[model samples]
Target: MQIEVLVDVKTTLGEGPLWDAQQERLYWIDSFDGRVFRATADGREIRCWDVPQKIGSMAIRKDGRGAVVSLARGFHFLDFQTGDVALIADPEPDKPNNRLNDGKVDRRGRFFAGSMDTMEEGPNGALYRLDPDLTVTRIDDGIIVSNGPCWSPDGRTFYFNDTWSGEIWAYDYDQDRGAVSNRRSFAKVDRSRGGAADGSTVDAEGFLWNALVYDGRLVRYAPDGRVDRIIEMPVKKVTSVMFGGPDLDILYVTSMAKPPLPRFPGDGVLRGSLFAIHGLGIKGVPEPRFGG
Candidate 1:
């Protein structure tokens, strides 16, 4: 695979890369810096938007105008032009230590976000689903740090990750009813490899590609739970991966410049930069938009 640098913004915790196909642009967030980035495919002309709090994850709106962002305490719809925000919901008013983490919109267009305690003290996190009717529901509990929420190509399988336990779980999904059940272990990370699970996405073939954060690599798992392929990255702290471009054949990856210690101990030239890998012979499906 040919890997290229997409952008060299050098974000502290670069993550949540989303492609706007209609506009032919990419959007991602820096969770530690409370900044959002917009860039062209070639990395020319990048822009930044500052949100009030750290934006861990976001989903594009149905109208293609902006994104519904998951902030520290709650959810809010953000304006793309003015960076204006409107309150959506605050489900965890009592858990001051918890913050919203990775999220994605389901096939039914419902937005789901998992909350986790910032300090990783306990299993105080929970998975929440936001409906188009502006209602919120707690779907799963006992999470330390929630990640990975991607669906199978057929929309029947729902995959999610619990970072602290290093396990990825799969569920039987009902797209029409917006329900998930029959949870089972799909894949588990080998923490001995010096990495934990992070953000993930599904390809056209229904394979799930997960970022092994501190391992500086992304692993693709087949639907049957086999390790299909592993793509090693130059930088340590790989945060997220998604497929974009007009044909959805381009793989965009985000990383963090985690300091104090490097994972592999090298020069780290590409640390904290956006990366693109092409000609992998795989493509991606369109990301579901937030219905609300």
Candidate 2:
């Protein structure tokens, strides 16, 4: 496979690469920078908007006008035309030390996101779901750092991970009711090979692709949780991954330029750049938009 830098914006902490198939465009976030970016499939004609606070993730609206974003404190509706933000709800108003993190939309068009402790020291965060009617519900709790939210091909299984815990969990998802239960450990990161799990997406064949932040490894796991493949990235601070391009054959990855703590040292020269991987012979399912 071939990999090339699509954009060299040098984001502080870039995450959430969302491809809009209907418009043939791409949307991503500079999490810590509070910036939202949109670009053509070729990474040209870029447009950017600044949010007032840090953003964790974003999903396009079904109407295609704007997006529902997980800001630092809560969920908000972002208008692309005017760059306006309207707060929806803050599920954890009591936990002032926590902030919303990685998230994705389910096949049924509900947005699912999890919060994380800003200090990264305690499990004060919880996973939440925002339904189409604009109501929010708490799904799970006791997470230190949340990331990599996605679903299986059949929509029966849900996958998410708490970065500090080093394990990815699988849950039996109720598509009709937008509920998750029967949580079990699906896979654990080999800290010897890579860092923690950051972001993930499922392929057409049901294999899961996850970016291991701090170690620069993109791992693909079979449905049974076996290692299918691993591609070493040029930058060590790889933050997230998504399948984009017109045919959904390209893998778009996001990274960070700013070093986290002394423990995760050594940043590469090409850090914070967006990358596109081609010739993988793989295609991803269409990302569902927020029905609300």
* Candidate 1 accuracy as TM-score: 0.95
For each of the candidates, give the backbone clash count: 0, 0
Deviation in angstroms for 24 in model 1? 2.0
Q: Model 1 clash pairs?
A: none
Model 1, 220-271: lDDT tens digits are: 9999988999998888689899899888899999998654234243327678
- Please report the candidate that would top lDDT against the real structure: 2
- The CA lDDT of each predicted structure is 0.86, 0.92
Model 2 per-residue lDDT at 187: 88
lDDT of 2: 0.92
